[model samples]
Target: MRDTGYSLRNAGCSLLPVRWGLFAVAILILAAPVAASGPTNPPNPTTVILVVGAPGQDEFGRVFAESARLWLQACEKGHAQSIAIG
Candidate 1:
């Protein structure tokens, strides 16, 4: 082969800048999701699901019912939707 002064070592050195540029682009692309995932307030009101387990005793049942009522009141004040399940 003619000595054209080109070898594998020099070939890799010449491509160093291109490799670094590709790496930088890849890093930016990977970070895009993380940047876009930042917190933002929703446009609509929130929804709350209030679940009251089985109150085995009469006293427990009254307390559970009272708790549910309080939650419903708070939901109304906040303009949120509340679903209660027993």
Candidate 2:
């Protein structure tokens, strides 16, 4: 057989270290859940501040009011505090 300067043994040897490194990383990723299984505090509620701009026309004012109402409804649904300012 002609020596092609490339063989399975040489390729496998070069990749062995990389394979081991990847295996170690996989092990760490799998173990993260176990490390995170500790007592945790509940997160604080979020507050949303909705600012309505001055509408140039009556129609724009109505639209802004409706938008604010919708945002208030969503905040209530999400159990978040909301402050609406025009």
Taking all chains together, each candidate's TM-score versus the true structure is 0.49, 0.50
- lDDT of candidates 1 onward, in order: 0.91, 0.90
Q: Write the per-residue lDDT of candidate 1 for residues 1-86, one digit (tens) a residue.
A: 68999886777657678899999999999999989999877865689999999999999999999999999999999989999888
Judged by lDDT against the true structure, how good is candidate 1? 0.91
Q: Worst lDDT window (10 residues) for model 2?
A: 36-45
**Shift in Å, residue 48, candidate 2:** 0.6
Best by lDDT: 1
The local lDDT score (0 to 100) that residue 77 gets in candidate 2 is 92
lDDT of 1 at 80: 90
Which residue runs does candidate 2 get wrong by more than 4 Å? 1-43
- After TM-score superposition, the amount by which residue 55's alpha carbon in candidate 1 deviates from its true location, in angstroms, is 0.5
**Candidate 1: residue 15 Cα off by (Å):** 46
